[model samples]
Target chain A: MSLASAPPVRARAVLPGFRLTFGTTLLYLTVIVLIPIIALVIEGAGIGPARLWDIVSAPRTRAALRITITAAAVATVINAVYGLLMAWVLVRYRFPGRGLLDALMDIPFALPTAVAGLSLTALYSANGWFGAVLAPMGIQVVYTLGGIILAMSFTSIPFVVRAVQPVLEKLDPALEEAASSLGASGWTTFRRVIFPAIMPAWLGGVTTSFARSLGEFGAVVFIAGNLPFKTEIASLLAYIRLEEYDYEGAAAVALVLMVLALVLLFLSNLVQIRAARYGAVTA
Target chain B: MTRALLIGLAVVTTAIFVVVPLVYIFVQALGAGWSAYAANIMHPLTLHAIWMTTLVAVIVVPVTVAFGIGAAWLLSKFQFRGRGLLITLIELPFSISPIIAGICYLLLYGRQGWLGGFLARHDLDVLFALPGIVMVTMFVTTPFVVREVLPLMQAQGSDQEQAAVTLGASGWQLFRRVTLPNIRWALLYGAVLATARAVGEYGGVAIVSGSIRGKTNTLPLHVELLFNDLNAAGAFAAATVLTMIALVVLVAKTVLEHRR
Candidate 1:
């Protein structure tokens, strides 16, 4: 299979629909995805660097970005630890309701974000189920930073669990046995052997989770107070700008988010590539 | 003891984080009793939102499935220049936020957008209408079917396809007989995912839909409207419909995963 060369000239084409499929794919992608994204870039570029900096550097913009990043980081941390635990348990153990638990992991992906947001907000509001329990302790979740992180974590949890599960399942038991035979404790074996095996995939998942959390709007918006400088997230900020007809402002903020998401996604792809290489070596 | 402890922790965390909220949706939806819940679902605006959402899914699922098949076939069967870039571009919408996608469409089709003037002159109303909502939903859910199908096609390879071609099969016959059978489960799985996403898409649609009460509101949008209006019971009732769709998608996914 030639990677960069023209299609090989054959007396008979082995498979059909090359031209038709390729043309349709290209046309659909250009109209549906490429052109719209290009429009965003062009709009952002049309704003001169000086004004772009002004928009980004403005207090409200900076606050929103900071809150988004901070909450996402917090959420990613929660997912990283919790996801690893879930993946390890799901892959390595059997218990009653295990399949049900496994299927439930995807609720975040399957459930609409707006519904997730509403449900979460309800469950954490002062009079709500969990919120009622925490309110007396002065641990308010809704309309606070905690709610933002909770919403982010809830929406992005599957990324980590799903990412790490396959890697953990594929891990060779012999490596752990070897570590144990060498007098390593169970914890040591996990830290030295199992940890390294799943590290790449875990990192990839965590990065992707962070990226998803950063742009999470529907899930976070309902829970977040949306107070301009307090709990407002960057994506919501962009929407607010749009609502105010500040298209340039919206584009500038969105460009920042788009770049962040793309860079993280690129990083994730790189990590997955590395993980694939690592898997090849181990297998 | 250690095994039990670990298992217990995992189960509890999953319960709190995953299961509780799901149950909460239904509970809240029914908190006002079955009669009230039925009334909320039967509300004219809510009914219209459901219809609108279903209409969008009916249109989006088939179109996206076709695109997915075309793109998967092209990428998996043929190797060429910029294939990697093309694949990346195909998955671009996954990384970008849906709200940003809305903005992208708005920038292209809004009244003051790039083609906004052109569209206005032509009397084309794309933004704040069905077209705009459909476009953004398409953008957000485009990657699902392709992502699901491409890897399976690549792994299965074109050997069977080659055999069919040598058997004097026409393009349509080859795909319908060989490729379609091999990928039908995955294609359906992708379609299921796309439907879930299309039905539930909120942010991008929210940006473009203008939230016209009975005209443009999708179910998810309607839920938000109800929630913001402090009608928790009404919001959850509408959300219950979306939740049911999500549950169905989950079941489809599990079945497809087993078959695949």
Candidate 2:
């Protein structure tokens, strides 16, 4: 009976044809992704070790790195709290113009970096609208660290909100209701429950925003005035290096930026993995 | 109660910082009288910049979408050794600063680049050429469609594909009949996003583009050139057009999201 009546049942034993797909994927990525990155390393190799050392150790490169890291860190920290709140508002409230506010989160994503830079500079420049008010307070923005932070933060905000918004939407409302029902206050419930669930996403957003801010060039250049040893970013320095045809120097600095970006993305992936694992455990 | 306050603060901050500046650019651009606006908008360079930008988008959007579909199909449907690493690598461009992306292509195809001299000896000029600009823009915009489409493909199971296979569907038939229908919306969404980004891309393209007026200068670069030339009104006018496209993207994304 088993032989005569049994239906074809090798499906479980025979997995889908993943081998073909995987091979194609590998080839595609190798062509598009690995080769370019490897080419960078190879081109960088021609410069040799001592020159690489000099490139990374140069005062200007150091200054650029410092500016990049400082501005990125400050922008990330600012957005971490604010981004979460923005996500929370979009998810929790039904206020007037909510759709407009929600749509606004993506403005940074679509706006050209150069245009954003110019507009931000216009708004914050001494002769610009906001600058008029800021200047009277003796708080200069154009060509300063403050302006860089503002511009970077502007471009990087969506990374945080977009990352966190989905998590916020999926959060269980009944959990909050249950906590309140059980006599737990709103603050306590959030601290104990909501925060734990959203913290990982929030962290992911921060890391992404930080990485974006670190690599930002267009928006920062327009407003920062590209002053060396002051507002110049790692990216701008790399650009300047290219402008001067310092190819080796530019590659060296770019390699450093690439490594830093890789580290941040690695960390972000780690957090995402942990978040998924934790979600599974809790579920 | 405190949560409400927190939400309010977030909404307000995002609106003020992210939204206002975007809207303000266009408003300021249009602040001039209609006669001045007509004159500003009708400049030969303005038309040329728009045409160049559209040409770049027309070429870039299709090639990118194709690359994205192929890459996304492979990533979503396949499970193999180094799959995670490959996926991570595919996204590296998105994370790496665009400035670095420009440098990467320059290293590969610039005048003194690895293949640069090889191509040059063959009379091929990539850098400071339209081919160079499009290639760099393609690099920057590659991740957009794949990022959008791949996740949705993953979430929607492959049972329909299996069913088609059981029904004796060829690879093309299965993809066209089963996979394409499920992913069409996602594909369109991704294409739109990629187009918007490509149109607005400045950092990488600016590097490789050489910004020769009426030749390689894209709209965004043109705006920068105008601004630098201290023709603030002209820069603002061009920027306003870019902002209008951005607004359309915003509305499109919102509508698409709501439909989803």
- Tens-place lDDT per residue, model 1, A198-245, is 898799889989999998999898999899999999999999999999
- Write model 2 residue lDDT over B23-100, tens digit each, in one string: 778766778866777777789998899899999999999987877777666666654456556666767788888888
lDDT of 1 at A278: 56
Off by over 4 Å in 2: A1-32, A280-283, B1-8
Error of 2 at B41 (Å): 2.3
The sequence of per-residue lDDT tens digits that candidate 1 reaches over residues B7-103 is 8999999889988999999999999799999999999999999999999999999999999999988888876777777878888888999999998
TM-scores of chain A in all candidate models: 0.94, 0.88
Candidates' chain B TM-scores in the order shown: 0.98, 0.93
Q: Mind giving the per-residue lDDT tens digits that candidate 2 earns over A1-283? A: 0011111222332224455555655665565456767878897888999999999999989998998899889988888877877888888888787877878888888899889999999988887878989999999989999889988998898887888888888888878888899999878997988888888888888988999999988888889977889988998888888989989988999999999998988898788878876771122
Q: Which pairs of residues collide in model 2?
A: none
